[model samples]
Target: MEGTMSESSAPRFRVLMFPWLAHGHISPYLELSKRLSENNFHICFCSTEINLNFIKKSKTFDEISSIELVQLDLPDLPELPPQHHTTRNLPLHLKSTLERAFYMGKANFQNILSTLKPDLLIYDAPQSWISELAALNHIPSVLFIIVAAVNLSFFYHAVNCGIDGTNEAYPFPAIYYRDYETKKMIAMSQESKESLPEDAAFSPKCFELSSFVLVKSWREIEGKYIDHFSFSCGKKVLALNLLNVQDDDTKEEENNSHIMKFLNGKDESSVIYLSFGSEYYLSKEEREEIAHGLELSNANFIWVLRFPVGDSIALEEALPEGFLERVKERGIVVDGWAPQAKILEHPSTGGFLSHCGWGSVTESMYFGVPLLALPMFYDQFLQARLAEDIGVGIEILRGENGQTNREEVAKAIKMVALENEVGELLREKARELSNQMRGGGEGVLHEAIKKLKDLCSKNK
Candidate 1:
């Protein structure tokens, strides 16, 4: 079956996009789908129903009729139900179970392939079997890595050189993880290994099987790392140059007036926007330290707090006692969700107190908001370092034992947001990057689309 033909009688490449069951992964895939749909590609975006529902509700897709949503159903296990199919509010322990369930849905996904018979497949890196599945149907597959190129390069280096090898240090020294973080990463890696099947394909295998790789970054910020990653992987690594910025959702804007109102009242470059992304939950100690730090920073701020799926902890109870009353005048503590892009783009948003998630980092950079980085896990540490290395942010280094220090948090916030030399320099650099990133990416994106077309044409 030849895919859908455009009005001009040209065959529009039908591409199946399967991202891992995480908001971070799914969101970029959707954005990529939108981009491709505009350039004569029909996209079948496949994910669990729960995730697809969120995408369906997004206003970004309202006009993009070429992008179709396809649901990949996972078997409902006792602990893993339809509601828990996504990683949004999922507990850390159930993460492995979700992966297992995702893998178990292979047959269902295979059926989807049989029905769609797409020209190409673009899949997330975690589910390495996706490439194999696509190959089985003679479909070309590309690995879409949502993480930063620096992180991928670091991991590739570590894996190739052995993490414990003293003979070879990572090529980039600025992006090294702390001792405690290293320990945590090792433990998590071991846990993942024990939980998943022994034959499960990882990054190396995924790179091997893919026709090419798509990284969610641009050349300006990570040219060296992108080049390094390509050399390491021995595959054509194409930068999607997808910043994942969208027009503010009209529905969300109407509901989030209070947040904008709060920002309007603040002075320009005086408020810090605080959010730790959706997946990572803070411990009580971490929460209290941050609350106290916010109090100490004395900067006007909008802090968004989120809890796990089943947790019913109240806002007052979760924060430090008297913290709300103390900072009420200068700060607004939002529960659950907020319009992040809107807040970042606002004039009052001076610094982003972020977990250094790639999505958050890119958004922050796009808006020229300097970062007060507080990275928690995974590639976040590297992303935080990248922001600092690029002169766009400052990392709040933890204690030697890896404990969050309130004073350090406050110091970094003041340093990044306040009108000091350091803050001024960071903000200027951020604006410079924002200008570059905004004006750039068109050439890269066009080249990437051309490559996709070439790949699909060859398969045909």
Candidate 2:
């Protein structure tokens, strides 16, 4: 649906969307743009050329006529070339450099805003300067958070109280991090602090600058966390229901015959689909343990493996010896990418062995696939805990040092995928939640659209 003129035949409100330079961030922003466009809002979707090129290739991009892809060019740095502008397959060491490059594109972004003169700006956090720029142009800005509200609320709590030596405990008991994870979190925080400018505005300050905030989640699953975050930030938080559920069967059929064929041969509710998202890659030990665990579980499975850019390590080198031969009939290992949504929607896929990225968690829930959660890092641990807390998934606990063993992984797979009382209960709960989510988001989305329009009108 394309946006139409108002009853008075006035021009549709124009929104400029600026997401951070990561696939995860860009994807949610694109989905939100689609929603806004359908509500009679013209959207100027801005990103680096590489990222925009990627969006142009997507099947969904062809269907949206109301959105215009605008390119925001970063300064030409020899180390950070055009291809490296996006975070897809980015080298770990160059991450900070990429951020610096993104920050340097402020002048170019300002030019875009000036040329487009959008009535509103919808942007991601950590780019708090955007709200200020939008205000200078007499436009309202809304910060769109792509992660789970539970994860954001936890950070807000920690930052408000000190990370260490806090007198008050985090409000949610179920979402505490392990010792190793806590240490890693602190280290990451310090690293980010050092990399950016002293006055760089993070989430807390970004929340203050926005007219309102939007999270890519619904109240059905995260009401408490969303309420907590809204109260703490003093911003009206609107929830955008699960935004990435692709319904494009035509594209799936054209690209995924081999994978669909493999899944078609499997029994109903018998195959486990494993993936750790696009950005994260497993260590050698982690790969061996997961491979051995799949062997031990004796469950049919499909696992997607990814390697960092320019890394040429073969599958045999990455996995345990003879692992492929051992599971030839029962398993398929895809390198780089797969049709994740299609696989989850398949009747044969009963469980998802995942790193529990928020996107993956929502997709699994939408398809009523029980989660075999093995959260690896950052907000993933919190998302994994939320999945378990809701009784739609079970976590594969690691040691105090955050080491995963084959036994735990196998146990989690069997408990979630095999025919048993626990698995049955989880499946039922997943279906219930899916039903609630599918049935209830239209009202919330309409309410959010009204709020956005009100903001635009006030500024006009």
Candidate 3:
């Protein structure tokens, strides 16, 4: 960071940031890069080739003039094609190959670090090995955690607690679901311990090593969790305030897509916006149930439904029979990406049928869109729990075997979107918090930057 006080003669600080190669991680890092660049820091934003291509295509990437895009030349692996550089496009089995390719870039990253000698090195989940490189050269490394603060706090607590796998009452938010049980964590840990590289094993140590922590969430929605995260880590933890969810003037092309046009024609606060995050794809069964639910609710909707990365089947084949024909007048089932921020900000988007990814949750809350959470994987269940606890959304329940039906989904959407009393209450809470969040973000960023600058200057 540059000096706290802006003067023409202030030293230009250089910052290097590398996030995990998933869209969910890269999106926030890019947003942070743009925000930090506003304060006159030059940022080197690093990602693998595939991710860089994706970033290059984003509207925001071109606007970030102060940020230099650095592409990592990952080493080729036996079973992986050149295009399979990121986990997003890779099949489940090739995940290890992806890991191998990631570590192969460490030497190249070392060379870059030596040349840039950045004042601050901020990294996310996958770059844990970079901390030692930064430390050896007297650079201040900060962990820009991209998960919910509650999730971070819980992970830290679980890792340090040294409990047996059978410890059933682990008193964490993640324990809301049976899948997030102690046994599951233990199994996951065992798998990682056996298969993960030594560098990968040290990934969690970034929490212990970094100068401080920066998370994607703010105190407005997760203050207690944030406080616990800081205390648990015994370091400063600051929020970037859901950087991608701001109300600033964005590139019109990004938001003016057909989804927004559809939203434009709907009644105010009447249409439910449905989309899972980019990383996860729903099964055919899941999609049909959701499509049926949307149709049954008689709610106007704009749904961004996607197939698994390279599957090229007709969208109608995956959805319920004649579903599109039945709801075509009132709903538009999008087959690809939608401008999520723009959709949420649209006055017509009343409720979000979400996967409860922290990014999606934050974006919905920031735009005052209540969530109808259908969490499918890690930490999402916890996020859904938080949404319910905050009285901003209702979770769509699942059976003991994690199955959800159309009727249950339909009822949850109606509760969040059309039920007058319940919908109004959630809407009010969401709107109030959204306003408070937008106002609080800049101050938090300013203070965090000031403190980080002081620390970096000392390192210099």
Find the candidate with the highest lDDT and give its number. 1
Please give the ranking of all candidate structures by lDDT, highest first, separated by commas: 1, 2, 3
TM-score of model 3 vs. true structure:
0.90
Candidate 2 residue runs with Cα over 4 Å from true position: 1-8, 199-201, 246-255
Answer with 2 or 3, whichever has the higher TM-score.
Answer: 2
Q: Flag clash pairs in model 1.
A: none
Off by over 4 Å in 3: 1-6, 162-175, 180-190, 246-258
lDDT of 3 by residue, 328-412 (tens): 8889887756667878888898999998988889888888889998987667877888898888888887766677689989998
User: CA lDDT of each candidate?
Assistant: 0.86, 0.84, 0.78
TM-scores vs. true structure, each candidate: 0.96, 0.94, 0.90
True lDDT of residue 418, candidate 2: 74
**Model 1, range 378-430, lDDT digits (tens) per residue?**
88988999999999999997988789999999999889777578888988999
Error of 1 at 123 (Å): 0.7
Q: Please tell me which model should have the higher lDDT, number 2 or number 3.
A: 2
Q: In lDDT terms, how accurate is model 1? A: 0.86
